[model samples]
Target: MATYEEVKDIPNQLDKYLVDVRNKSELKETGTLPASINIPLPDLEKALNLPDEEFKASYGRVKPSTEAVVIFSCKAGGRAARAANLAKTMGFANAKAYPGSWTEWAQKEGK
Candidate 1:
């Protein structure tokens, strides 16, 4: 899991996820970090079941190496935490949660 302070380092890290586990409206309105992807909490399981190309089509990228680290974020981290846990359960090797999430991110970004 990641703290607000730790989240600051994500941009500099390789293969880190900046997922927004928010709903579509939230995503459409506010988006996520620069390189982050959208994988709403509700769609996570089906997403995990998709083929790599479908994953790419859905989220704009193919699956990362199982060893690659990824982070999930949301309004206040609840959905992010759940999503991260689900990702790990679905066989992702290093899924983690950004506890501060978008609430903290927007605060940091002055949005």
Candidate 2:
């Protein structure tokens, strides 16, 4: 699990597939990480696509095309870590969990 600062600094470098596992209500209330795609744990597979067709075409991107570094974040660390592990089992070689997710980000104020 990466710390908030550690993850935040290089988040853009990991833009290929950053998945935020926060629930819809939480996302509406607290917002999300930059370039993060929301895919609740239950809907992960279904939502596993490029951010959008326009962006994908312009950026020369496609999802599930490679074993990407999929970073997962939830309210706290638990769900994200679980999602990361699950992603690994599902063949994503570089899945990581941001343990200090929005809860810690909110506490910092600058995030």
Candidate 3:
């Protein structure tokens, strides 16, 4: 899980990598972080089958060797953590979960 400090630093680090796991409804309701790609968990199975060339074409050449960190985020911490763990198991060694997800972001946005 990412700390508060890490969340604060995301904007700067985002240029390198960031992935948003919120569903379509959630994304439509709330704006996402800059450069964050929407990859809903339900769609993961389909994503796995995407041709490597297609994946690279769409997501900018992500190989097992890609150095960018993959941060998964959802409404709350739970789903994001699950996605992060899955990503790690699937060879994304730098996957991380943002505990302060949309719920926290929404609360802060109100203030």
lDDT-best of 2 and 3: 2
Model 2 lDDT tens row, 19-52: 7887889899988876777778887654553365
lDDT of 3: 0.70
Q: Candidate 2 has what TM-score?
A: 0.75
TM-scores, all models, native as reference = 0.86, 0.75, 0.75
lDDT of each: 0.80, 0.73, 0.70
Q: What is the Cα-based TM-score of model 1?
A: 0.86
Error of 1 at 48 (Å): 1.7
Report the C-alpha lDDT of model 3 over 4-56, residue by residue, as the tens digit: 45655677774445567888888888877655677788775456457877766
Q: How accurate is candidate 2 locally (lDDT)?
A: 0.73
Q: Which residue pairs overlap in candidate 1's backbone? A: none
Alpha-carbon shift of residue 77 in model 2 (angstroms): 1.2
Ranking by lDDT: 1, 2, 3
lDDT for 29 in candidate 3 is: 82
Total clashing pairs in model 3: 0
Candidate of highest TM-score: 1
| Candidate 1 lDDT, 5-91, residue by residue in tens | 656777777567667778888877876676777877888889778888988887887666667787888998899889989888888
Model 3, C-alpha of 27: deviation from truth (Å): 0.7
